[model samples]
Target: MRTAKDRLRHTILFELLGLVTVTPLAALILNKDMGRIGALAVAISLLAMATNYVFNLAFDHALVRMGRPVNVRPPWMRALHAVLFEATLMLITLPIVAWWLNMSLWQALATDVGFALFYLAYAYVYNWAYDRVFPMPSAVRIKAADR
Candidate 1:
């Protein structure tokens, strides 16, 4: 299991990097004002950040229970992780984005789907990089194995 601080750091960095990468692209693709897109992006980022912490903790625990090493997921598992995270997040964020942007549900869903696809790729790469950079401490891994 990761410490609260580690989780916090992961969430913060994930959102910060995502916001930087996605904001301008979303603005350009969506053809909306940057400020409007930025605000929506920030709202989505904040929600995703909170959801990420909780979801990752649960995911890690599930992996440990299943006798998988949390830090060394298989590629298939990594794909599942990204898809599951975005699927859940899209559910929570779609309505919020529609309300904030005053768009119809269909429009919101389309927009959210676009974000989801980007995040699916982003999450896969980000987690792969993050694991390499900040591996699970050996002590934590050993303890998880003991379970």
Candidate 2:
């Protein structure tokens, strides 16, 4: 398990890095001004930050309940997590994306799917790196050892 402070740090770093990388790419790909894309990026990032914090907390708790080490998510679990995260995020962002870019729902869905795909890959890699860089305390293992 990680402390609240650690989770907060993780969320902040993830969002900041994502924004830096995604904003320019989104603008270029969409043929929009950087400011417009940047604003949208920031908005989506804010929503994601909140979701990331809550989702990860719940995910760790699920691992604990399942007798799995909180620090080590299996590949299957990681994939599921990334997929679910992106799916939910895309749903939330689709309307906002359409409004911001003045696109129809179908266009927004297409654009959102692209964003989701990028994030699906990004989330997997980012989490792998994050876990390596800031390993979580293995509460489950430690508890089992005491038994």
Candidate 3:
């Protein structure tokens, strides 16, 4: 339901803020160099940015078809969706992250989980703030409700 420009803004802001937060935290937590953490974070952020665009588009389309509005997802549904999405993304990113950082696969998995937890919370808060700060236009909201 978001315009392309809005979605682009979301992607950029999400990644930028995430990089700012995650790099330092990852370095501190994992006892890695800042350069390593920053590189890994950037790689993951790029992958996530692409995935975010596709996943959101699909999710919105499904919601519309299911007569579900965008504002509130059921708690259980959100939990399941978030966990599944993170898990799938971790699988895709873990190897690259580990290889880049010269870590074992298990280490990578654990590290990825740590980041995922952070992002899960970040995404929830970010989206809540995003909606409040840049709410859907009144016309679109009315049209969506009428449907």
Candidate 4:
């Protein structure tokens, strides 16, 4: 498990890097103004940062209870979770994204999917690197075991 401060760092770094990389690409691919794309990206990133905290806390708690924590998530489970999360996010942001870009709902949906794909990959890589760089504290391991 990560400390709150560490998690905040992770969220900030992840979103910052993502915004730098994705905003331009999104603008080009979606043929939208950079300001629109960048604004949307910032809003989405902030929301995702909040969601990241909640989701990871919940997942860690569940894993501790399960006892077999910290390994590769099953492919099916990963896919399911990713799809559900993306769909929920799409619902929340579609109207905003659409209105911002002056696009239709379907256009927004497609754009959202593109962004989701980028994030899905970014998440996997970020987490892998984060674990390597800042692993769970031994205290957390001990706590997990005691639970």
TM-score of each: 0.91, 0.91, 0.86, 0.81
What is candidate 4's lDDT per residue for 1-147, written digit by digit as tens? Answer: 667898888778878998899989988997878997888889888887788777766766776678645444555655555566566667778888888778899988888888888877777676668667877665546454455
* Model 1 worst lDDT run, 10 consecutive residues: 137-146
Q: CA shift at 102, candidate 3, in angstroms? A: 1.5
> Could you tell me which residue pairs clash in candidate 2?
none
Which of the predicted structures, 1 or 4, would earn the higher lDDT when compared with the native?
A: 1
Per-candidate Cα lDDT values, in order, are 0.88, 0.88, 0.81, 0.75
Pairing residues by index, what is the TM-score of model 4? 0.81
Residue 92 alpha-carbon offset, candidate 2, angstroms: 1.3
* lDDT for 147 (candidate 2): 36
TM-score result, candidate 2 = 0.91
What are the clashing pairs of model 4? none
Ranking by lDDT: 2, 1, 3, 4
For residues 1-147, write the lDDT of model 3, one tens digit per residue.
689999989889989998999899989998989997898888888998898888887877777678677666555666665676677788889889889988899988888888899888787777768877988654435375546
In model 2, state the lDDT of residue 117. 88
Error of model 1, residue 118, in angstroms: 0.5
In candidate 2, residue 82 scores what lDDT?
96
